[model samples]
Target: MNYTLHQLQVFLKVTETKSITKAAEQLYLTQPAVSIQLRNFQDQFDIPLTEVVGRQLYVTEFGMEIARAAQNILNEVQAINYKTMAYKGKLSGKLSITSVSTGKYVIPFLLADFLKQHTEVELVLDVTNKNRVVRSLENNEVDFALVSLFPDLSVQSIPLMENQLVLVANRDFPMPKKPLTLEAIQALPLIYREAGSGSRFVMERFLNQLDSKGTKKMELTGNEAVKQAIMAGLGCSIMPVIGIKNELQNGDVQIIPAEGLPQSSQWNMIWMKSKNLSPVAEAYKNYLLENKSTIIQNHFGWTEQL
Candidate 1:
């Protein structure tokens, strides 16, 4: 049987308020009209939905179950209409984005060009560490998040770029004539990002693979903090090459080689699988994929494996 959109909307409203009078007031319809629609809905299903206990109208158990299914069906129908409208290239809306701290250095630059092309679209960006970014995505707090390490989530992930993790030390610090392996680096005092930051996880996993537990470390929150600590001769630490571009160039820090480090680590753009994305967000995602390498080269002066 066919159900009208208005019927679904009215049904959801009544379920939300649990009172037909309140639902009718909210929907701007008379109480009898609301009751008639509800009864018609139940008739279509060959079942009764409401019962009277004294003067109060209460939902039947069957009605509660049907209300749950109605929500899903209504949502799917709305999704189809939204996507149909988006596919016609009528892109005009706001895009909300959240990203890990290092992504601040990358995503904003990419978005700038995207904004220039789509001048009418509004953009909102939030830059936080990995934990906050993940929590925001989980709570529907942001449309998309750029992260260096993949989050432990059941979200849709688009592989955007790969960043190399490198060991950096102050240029003035003493270094051995030979390259250091994971085992050798673990012996040195290390400055690192907080637990949830992607760089820390990558470095720690690399150390773990080499039989080092990674207990010889000091935790710093931001990229600048770790960079400054290393520049102050706080000992060497593994950091994202993307974050240390200027420091590496200005002779403030040195990139040291480590054995068994992966050639590069993968970074992903992620969002909740079940969430609906606006046309503007979908357009920006397309823009990022189309200009992935250029985005990296322009931001960090280095080519990225897209």
Candidate 2:
């Protein structure tokens, strides 16, 4: 009962890292300071929260239960702070969004005006692969997920804009001497986004529909890595033009003109339908729905030429 939030924070960090030394480094405190706080916190509990065996720190089962409760307390404290700010007439709260890696190209532009209007809002964006982004949404770890692919999940969507995927290769790659055939294009070295990527899923589906089950010569985790690989002439890949606009314009890469190329999908903002949106989340959702037309016109209208 005498424990402070800082002690709880220190204790939680220790539990997470399983080492007071690491926790101190992460928390930016000296080892002795962390040890003092940890000792002080454990004194409040009836049972020992942590133990050392063979130089390794371990949190006891009671420690885990305490840590869970501590997390809830911290979450409540954050919620109270957000509420206090709202009452002062400045739209403020944490706005956490996870986007598939390629979405880095688009989400920020969409967020600019809204954030400008509500400067007090805290923004946390995680740009990872689609699978991770969806996992965050499934666990309700994020308020919204920006994705181009809508898979089998219980989620609602707000259509934002068109996404264009095109076949591209290093600018120095030899132009096919004749009009390209799917087989001929498939014969060339090809790179792919790693498995579990939304872009890869779409690309694979598009290729399957064409009956061209081409094997990738190499696979990379992100758009930037794949871009660099292909630009280094490792192979060609079907990449979102959103991610490759600079390369496309700079002539570092060239689009491979082929039939059924430039596959299209819509980038959407999706969230769990069963969950209630917080004030900040709801406000952002409405802002996106209301301004998507302008956003698309300004940011993505160039995809039309492809």
- Best of the candidates, TM-score: 2
The residue-by-residue lDDT of candidate 2 on 150-268, one tens digit each, is 95789999988878888888999877656566776677788989898888887887777656677679988889999999889888888898898888899999887777777888899
Error of 2 at 154 (Å): 0.9
Error of 1 at 149 (Å): 2.0
CA lDDT, candidate 2, residue 112? 97
lDDT of 1: 0.78
Q: C-alpha displacement of 293 in model 2, angstroms?
A: 1.3
Off by over 4 Å in 2: 13-36, 51-58, 176-179, 210-212
After superposition of all CA atoms, the RMSD between model 2 and the true structure is 2.6
Tell me how far the alpha carbon of residue 212 in candidate 2 is from the true structure, in angstroms, after superposition: 5.8
Q: For residues 1-306, what per-residue lDDT tens digits would candidate 1 score against the true structure?
A: 776778878887888788899999989999999988887776788776677788777778887887888888886885676566557664556688888887876776768888888766667788998888888888886889888777778888778667778878899867678878667778888887888888888778777776557555588989899999999887778887778777876999987766765446777888889888866778888888889777766665563431
